[model samples]
Target: MAKGELVQAIRLLTAERDLPMDRIIEAVQEALATTYKRQYGPTPDVRVELDTDSGEFRVYAEKLVVIETQDESHQISLKDAQQYPGEPGLNEMVEVEVTPPNFGRIAAQTAKQTILQRIQEAERDLVYDEYANREGEILNGIIERVEPRGIIVNLGKAEAVLPLQEQVPRERYRITQRLKVYLVKVDRGVRMPQLVVSRAHRGLVRRLLEVEVPEVFNGTVELKAIAREPGSRTKVAVAARQEGIDPVGACVGQHGVRIQNIVNELNGEKIDVVPWDDHTDKFVANALRPAQVIAVLVHDAERRAEVIVPDGQLSLAIGKEGQNARLAAKLTGWKVDIKKESDAGGETQEAPVPPEPVAVAPGLPLDPADEPATMAELLERVPNEGRDEA
Candidate 1:
């Protein structure tokens, strides 16, 4: 490139790429030095300087001045060094200009490639710094491609990967689909900064709430805990930071608009916004929502609670597959043993009929009854047994 054009390009790069001019100049100097070494063999003392104003570059070879020259490349006689601008003395170093007559032509051939490579590196660093501090925030992105390893999302300034483990099991992604994702982390990669994002992280829900609820964003509502079964249901326990403000109501918004927006974003994932209570019993009861609890018996030493629900609410309390009770336990940090009120004599008791333990794997349905007996049969037998005992 012409000297004028080179100077203009540097200015354009500084303005367009948001890169400092000095960095580009340094890159050019390094590239030119490399070009010089390529043509004339390796020389450790060779240096290149580029004038910022004129975009003119020159190569200099630094050599030590000696009483008599022995090593031609490294040492120069005081008589020979005296010809340079700076007055030379024995044992002093002098920089001699060694710009080859056709050096500019050769540098031009490779300078563009090297400068572009350096600019790419600088851009990667800029992207990494921009996202390194956003580990917990949310970003809107479009699905770029669905690779076998993960989903690639175009996050405007950078691309992010939603690994298989981080995606919701039930959510399907398509090309060009738009969604909000949680920034899980930033990792240094071979070509660029690797942004790891997530759709199933609980933080996604937390951030979505902050976006939708004014109270949550301003700290008028504090989220105490969250228990989530991605693609299925999530329970959020919230408490008011200020008195007379309803935390649950604020998160739910007017007519449930706030929570609904979050649900829609999550592809219809169910979210339960429950009030947080300092009292363990009340907290546990609130955690198991849509299921009325007759009473709760706390065993503080064991960190367990024996919950008594009406006979009709057993299936509801246990959820379709023990999801309700499991999430309630997770939310309250307690082991919950749910039982029918009839089994507890219709009153709070220290101990109730310990139900038969059934081994159920995660994500599997819970029968709440022994094999060969359907839930209806177990329900019928229970009432009959109660009547017979009476």
Candidate 2:
């Protein structure tokens, strides 16, 4: 290629690969040096220089100046060295132009390969750095192809693996389909950056909330905890860092638009956004939404909480297959024993956990504290072994 074309090509590569010009130039020079050594014989030290702006390529044979040559390729007589640049003295090196007549073809081929390889390496690093900072963030991509182990998602600049274990059981993928995923891991690979992404991770819900809700993104609301059963249900505890902001309201958005968007993204997975409390009792109660917790008897040492709901709320709080109670326990990071006023007698019954709410009372609030009372008064409300909470 001509000098001007070579310079233009380097400029284009910088723009396309987003690599620095110096790196590309260095790769080209190194390739030219290698090519010169291979074709002209390897005994002499070869130096290649390319004017980044002018694209003027030059090759030099560097030989040590000596009174008498011991090795013809590496050493030159002092008398002969005086003819080269720097008018070298003994023990000093002198550079002489050794441009081969047919070198353009050989050097062009070698340098092109080297420059392309350099660009590829730089692109990999660029991709790795880009996603490293984005760990735990959500990204949208298209399904490129599926392998036996998992699906390959084309995430614009790179492709990521969504292993079978990380996929939602109820969700199916197809070619060219658009999908949203959470970047759960970034690992180094031999040739490229290894990215492990997921749709089933609990962090996916938190990331989606940050994306859809401005309040959550701006730090007005904080996601204190999240528990998820992929393609089934997710329970999130949100609290306002600053007073006067309704944490639940902020996450749910106007008319529940914000949460609904997140739900839609998760393929209709139900999400329950509730308030969080530092008080264990209150936090447990908040976690068990759609179920009224009359009071929570906690064993701090055991990290177990006995949640008592009114007889009427037992079924609702336990949820179908006890999903509500299960999620509550997960969200609170504690073992929860759900009892209705009737279950207080210490008998446990299996509740059918359905995907949807069954006979849930919409008006029932988590707290029934309209009437404040002392601990003794509250204990009086406990059922006689027969009372349990839902």
Candidate 3:
């Protein structure tokens, strides 16, 4: 390549890859240095310098000035070194120009492959730095491809992987389909930055709310807790941060437009926006929404609540397969034992001894066949159970 062409090529790369010119120049110098070492012999003292404006390059090799040279490549006799620009003394190191006569041709031959490799590496690092600080932020992406392990999404500047475990169970992905994803993490991969994104994460719900609800985004309302069964349902507890603002109303928007947008984004998942309370009893009652709660008796010692609902509301409170009661427990960070009002009677009932701690691992869903007969039994079977505030 001509002297001016090298500068133009670097300028083109800077614009095309969005990389700093200095970085590309550094990469080119390293590539040329490696080429020099490979073609001649491996040595640690070889350095390549390129003039950024003129785009001319030269190779220099450092040699020790010795009274008598034992190695021709690594040492120069004091008499021979003195013939160069600077007078040399014994045991001093000096650099001498060692540019090969045909180096430009050689550089042209090998520079493209080496330069591309270095550029790709620099691009990966730039992308990793950009996304590392955005771990919890939501990004819009298009489905690029589907593999057995997960779906690949194109997020404009980079491709992100939505692993199977992080994908919503009921959602299907197709090529070119656009959706929003939560950035889970940025992993250092062998070839590029591995962007791990998620569609099923509870954070997705939180971020979507921030986008659709002005009050939540501006901190007039705070999200107290969220309990979600991906692709099934989610319960959000919100509290008013500023007086005169209805947290739930602000989130729901006028005629439910804000919440509905979030629902549509999640592919029609059901969401319950309830008011949060500092009192555990009131919060628990609110969490089990659409079910008329007659009373909530709290046992502070065990973080348990005995909820009593009207007889007609029992089924609604328990919900299909005990989902409502389960989500209520998760949201309030309590062991909720829901019962019919008739069952509670007009007497104080001692909190039943929690059955022997169930050995199930926390967060793992119980098998359908092993599901308990009642909400009380189910809550008792899960250990170390609590809300996921993150």
Q: Write the per-residue lDDT of candidate 2 for residues 1-390, one digit (tens) a residue.
A: 877678799889889877888888888898789878877789467888887677667888877889999887788899998887678999998877778777766766777788788888878888898897897688999999998857999999888988776788899899999998987667656578767777877777777888898888898888777777788888878888898998887777777787788888989989888777777877888788867777777789999988777799988888899888888887887889887777675432323222222111111121223221332232233321101111
On a 0 to 100 scale, what is the lDDT of residue 280 in model 2?
81
lDDT of 1 by residue, 232-265 (tens): 8888888888999988888887777888888888
**Ranking, lDDT, top scorer first:** 3, 1, 2
RMSD of 3: 8.6
lDDT value for candidate 3? 0.78
TM-score of each: 0.79, 0.77, 0.81
**Winner on lDDT (1 vs 3):** 3
Model 2 TM-score, all chains together? 0.77
Model 3 vs. true fold: TM: 0.81
Provide the overall lDDT of each model, using Cα atoms, as 2-decimal numbers: 0.77, 0.75, 0.78
lDDT of 2: 0.75
Which number leads on lDDT? 3
